[model samples]
Target: MKTKLVLNFNPEASNLPITHNLIAEYGLLVNILRAEIDEIGGKMVIEVSGDDDSTNKGVEYLKKAGVGVRPFKEGVRRNDEICTHCGVCVSICPTSALILDHETRKVTFVEEKCVACGVCIDACPPRAMEILI
Candidate 1:
């Protein structure tokens, strides 16, 4: 099973090796999509892959560790009517969620890979990419 999680970490929790424990102890594969940390706290968008039981257990463990866990559904929304398909977002997207289709010469958005980092929101020339957290 694959799950996207948005984690909010408090200052105290920031010092913990949470990601390491999620992998080593929980037996899950962790892919960090987006991360931001500061003196006060931080936020991270991570993709975890494991069996159903392990994934659930990992989520439970996160909650127990005082980390705010939220399910990430839609990351970036593409407004077709507004999008020019100029491929502006293709280069800026870290996850390659936005791609330029060679056959059609159009830009394609793969929502499954999107991490909702909000980079495309400002880069889209037509104002097509909207971030929904």
Candidate 2:
């Protein structure tokens, strides 16, 4: 199973080798989408791929390690009024969530496919894609 998680690390938990343990011990593939940390602690957006049991175990492990785990629901949002549909975000979207409609020559934002990487936010010529998370 593939799970998208938002991890909150406290000051003590931030000092641990959490990612290394998740990969070596739980055997899960971890892809960090976005992260912000400091001496006090911070948050990270990560995508984990593994079997159902392993994924569940990984979450439990994070919880036991004093890290708060939550699902990632917020994603990129496009403001149609501001968007010019120039398709500038098409090539930059890592998940292909932003695409250009060949026939209509318009840009489309697929929220379900977006990983909230925030790449499109800066790549957008009109600044249409905004990361709410």
Candidate 3:
């Protein structure tokens, strides 16, 4: 089965030296399917697909490096009220997570398709995209 790992970085860990090593050593092995950072919140969400052992190893490494790691819940959606439907976010989404509903003519986001790249969030003019964690 595929495992999804999400890590939250504390402010101190952001500038810590071991952070780079943890990513370089462990992150390089895993699939690293998706990654996203919340600039405002100073948090990061990373998804990886692998067996339980590898996932555990990665999380252990991150913890040893002083980074906070956690498992993420699925089925998160965006708030339509703040969405402008400008369509700018659609193109920038590498995973095609966000799309314009043809019939509704409104923007829609699929949680599974999102790799948490955060590109759409950056592209969103109104900052409508949110991580439901």
Candidate 4:
């Protein structure tokens, strides 16, 4: 079985000290999927994959560190009407979770490869991709 996890960082919870401690403690192999800093806030998306135990452990570690998480299902499509298909998200996706289908030419989102970093959402100019619970 495969599980897709998504972590939504709250603007109020942006604390590097706690983030660093959690990463160090849990050995979270985080790869920066996307990062942006502006007047609004700082955002970063990361993808993490491992065995079931490791993945669950990572979730637990994040929860303890006060991060928000949601499990995403595979084959779940967001509002395509709002999707722009600009390919900006495809280029910024760190784990290759979002892809452009060669046959259909539509954006394909694969949950199995998602690290829950939420970068595609930020990269999305139209804000179409949604975090499904």
Ranking of candidates on TM-score, top first: 1, 2, 3, 4
Collision count for each candidate, in order? 0, 0, 0, 3
Write candidate 2's Cα lDDT for 83-115 as tens digits: 999988899888898889999999888877888
TM-score top scorer: 1
Per-residue C-alpha lDDT of model 1 across residues 1-133, encoded as one tens digit per residue? 8899999999988888989999999999999988889998988899999999999999999999999999998877999999988988888888898899999989989988788989899988779988876
lDDT of 4 by residue, 1-133 (tens): 2344445556655654534643576555655544545554455555555566766887777776666766544323457899976677888877788899878878887766765555666667888877532
**Between which residue pairs do clashes occur in model 2?**
none
Best by lDDT: 1
Q: Give the C-alpha miss distance for residue 131 in model 2, angstroms.
A: 0.9
Alpha carbon lDDT of residue 68, candidate 1?
95
- State the C-alpha lDDT per candidate: 0.90, 0.88, 0.64, 0.62
* Predicted structure 2: lDDT: 0.88
TM-score of each: 0.85, 0.83, 0.58, 0.46
Please give the lDDT score for candidate 3: 0.64
Candidates 2 and 3 compared: the better one by TM-score is 2
RMSD in Å for candidate 3, one decimal? 4.8
- Among all windows of ten consecutive residues in candidate 4, which has the lowest summed lDDT? 69-78
